[model samples]
Target: MSAHRLPGSGPLMVFGGPYSNLEATRALRALATAKGIAPENCICTGDLVAYCARPNDTLAQIREWGCTAIMGNCEESLVAQAIDCGCGFEAGSACDALSIDWYRFASARVTAEEREWVAQLPRQLGFQWNGLDIHVTHGAPSKTNRFLFASSKASSKREELDSTPAHVMLAGHCGIPFGETFDRENGDQGYWLNSGAIGMPANDGTADGWYLLLEPLAERVRASWHRLHYDAHSEQRSMIAEGLDNGYARALTSGLWPSMDVLPAAEREQRGIALQPPALMIEPNH
Candidate 1:
């Protein structure tokens, strides 16, 4: 439960779940550089290694990028030398089964020094941009691996928002991009945003990942979701070469997850359908 405050007013790029996909991670870094977003203004919500072939390369790339990163469940498990990813998947489920293969692959490749670096990452980040207080977390404020999907209950989201004082709370881990605004009991408006994962597709029937952009406008902060197109085929090939031809490897090009075990009914029903999450404008606190 560590937290750190970031200092910057520039446009921020927030993404998550790099998931050890070196190709996708490299694409995102190039995007940030082309957009003039400094490394300090870019934040990663974690899961730097997971169901991909190049765990060590991806971890090194992100570390070299020098962005603000929160420790995801994958990082926590890796650092603790846990046997599983700690994603809280139900026992005997497909997610649990698949995780076994990738987690073992990642754990074996990640070095002691890299785990030490991940060990020091904060669990949360807070910052002020354009008069708006923003909070960042890997999953939920209460639990790092909790899956709070777009279709999750509104009350649940409100509870997480209530735990933080920020006007906007940005999170990742659900692998989908969405935005919801809640009218607080105290009459203020609160926003919950999931930047989605760049390592994997949104299961949107397209071979593209997702990222979030937050920019300050005259009177409001504009939060938008953008698709990240990368060399998915190459990544898939890499996985096959590494003897890691799991569902996630195929998911790179297919844009579909192999299991619905972790998805709620709403998210499960929307599988293979492209996502078009709308942009949200938040008024800065006066």
Candidate 2:
């Protein structure tokens, strides 16, 4: 139930939260092509369709590229024919409101084939490489809608990790990229890697999106986060042209989310400051 053997056995690229920006999605695929990571080796953590202007285009891009994707809360909502996005946003919150617009847009545009494809996507993906077992999920093991942040309880994450029995976990849905290493000596050592969301900015006051590159090593897996440069001006233009919603449209260019609806206090405090994550930074002890 948990193990998959990737045919190529090459480095895999992981990303999340495409949010319907065709341009951003295209840029990501371009990066993969440049790196020679094929569609089978490139995995998306989910929400492939959401807040941007080109939901259909984004879906088409992913489909055309043939990357493997895990169903996010958005896909779950759409697949089950839920009225609103199952993002777990509170009613009347900014996220909830904005979500209504994008969700409706995405729901209306996704074709039958896309919906069927989304419905068929696996909830959890497991594969082995370099003597390590890697598990991929959109959120935590508990629910696809759950938001696991960098500041989320280590105890909570450890408890979730306990469920999978994996040496490393790749998670999405929090929209922030971070790599956390748990000590695990006293049941405290493991790695939680978030590829972040490529569709939207990280609220670091920059337009660059985030993705993770995992390279297998002799002793451990070396995972690093990279900032993706795309044309936010064009992404914003598309949003406005589509007449979806101005709040998210501006967020595209500003690189700061219009609403702090989902961000926790720790993340909210660091808003607007550019985040340049360290490079090739993780030397795992797994």
Candidate 3:
């Protein structure tokens, strides 16, 4: 329920799931700096540390950039000193088992101050661009660990949208980039966008990650998803060197997940298929 409002003039760059991939994190920061986007205008949807090898280094990079970040399930678990990641993966499933390895590695690597900083991060945030209210969260408004996929039913998305006061929801944690708008018969319109993960591939049979940019254009905001190309082979090498044997290490090069246990039926069926997220123009319904 804690909401921080971000003021947007130029494009607001949003990404998620650094996942301890130092290479991707560094690439994203370099891209933002080269484009002259202020650090404050760059928002991260959390999971700053997760499956990759350089958890502490990744956290350092994000902090140095000073990007506005929300707490993801991974951050929540790490901050709370919980037993497992809050991703809601089924017990004894592939995701759960794999998380055990990375979670332990990340938990042991982060500094005490880093843990405190993550513990204090807000669960949700709000901002405005081109007169449209935008909400940023790690998952659905109702649950930090909720999985709101692009393939979810329209009614489900509508329900999540109605639960929040913002006109648009910019979210992450599902690791897939999508922009969907829900319009009601009463003329109310809502937006749900997941810029996808910067630290990890979109399971699209490509090594490139994804990010989103929202640019104001007079009367509307243009929300565009862009692919991020980084040195995945280097990251994977680091992971192997660090003794991390999770499937995600190879996923960096293969652009596929080690397990489909976390994905819904629709998503599971589309595994290894490349994604081409389209640009969306959002205008105020009021």
Candidate 4:
């Protein structure tokens, strides 16, 4: 894991999956600006390009702003000129089909300079945040495209956590906000934090996307999820006009993904329920 040495300063904003939604990307940046956080303190877990219509503009925004981005599977594929989005979706599934469309759309849009930037993104970013070693990656350590949700297996979560030297593993890829504090009898503990995606909703029945903030508390790291309200309607319209897939176009405003091809039954069950992820304070029992 590479290191992105960020100062343990003011409220730190971390987000994922720009997914080519320029509107969402712009709105998220505004939110951080209004919150008084600088670009250097903000980090993106990465998928800088994806389903939406404005992949180029979105990448250009973050590139000019100079935020640290971990390499997402989408970025990796785009840089390598791969065939698919590399999410490891099932063959011939709706997810895979839509991915082919968007991947081609994005691949054609990104310029050489943007591809260079994607090549420069870190696979995993590690840093000491308020006495905790925090590592950020698009997905799990075993695979860049692996999906780990709130309902992921306990053993698998523990295994990934144990393999890492960081006390906190901040992930994206799943496009949903979830936090799990794993406690071990040996007195070691870690947190699996997914900041969620600002480019698209968590399929939880709201037009707003999600992001997470790490507010250091005494002896704990406060994980807070916030809704990012962007111009989804306009973005969706643009996607439609651009001849992109209608599934993500509808997803932009409906907060409902067109396919569950990538999700497990647990996540599929939560569709349209509207998430209200509460702020959690993490503390390891000594």
Best by TM-score: 1
Ranking by lDDT: 1, 3, 4, 2
**lDDT (C-alpha, whole model) for all candidates:** 0.89, 0.82, 0.88, 0.84
lDDT of 4 by residue, 104-209 (tens): 8888888998888788777887777677777777888888998999999866777776677776788999998988877643567767889999988899989898
TM-score of every candidate: 0.97, 0.93, 0.96, 0.95
Alpha-carbon RMSD to native, per candidate: 1.8, 2.5, 2.0, 2.1
Residues 137-193 of candidate 2 have per-residue lDDT tens digits of 888888888888988888777777778867688899988898887755345467788
Which prediction has more favorable TM-score, 3 or 4?
Answer: 3
On lDDT, the stronger of 2 and 4 is: 4
TM-score of 3: 0.96
Q: Candidates 1 and 2: which is better by TM-score?
A: 1
lDDT of 4: 0.84
Model 3: weakest 10-residue lDDT segment is: 1-10
lDDT of 2 at 208: 84
Residue 274, model 2: Cα distance from true site in angstroms: 1.3
Q: Which has the better lDDT: candidate 3, or candidate 4?
A: 3
> Could you give candidate 1's per-residue lDDT for residues 1-286 as a string of tens digits?
1224374788989998999999999999999999999888888988989988998899888878888889999999999999999999999999999999999999998999989988999888777788888888888989999999988987888888878878788899888999998887677888898999999999888989899999989889899999999999999999999999889989999999988898999999999999989999998864
Ranking by TM-score: 1, 3, 4, 2
Candidate 4 pairs with clashing backbones: none
lDDT per residue for candidate 3 within 1-286, as digits (tens), equals 1124364588889999999999999999999999988788889998988999998889888888888899999999998899888889989998989999899888998899999888878888876667887788898888988888988887777777777778888899999999998885456888888999999899989999999999888888899999999999999999999998568988999999998887889888889899988899998758
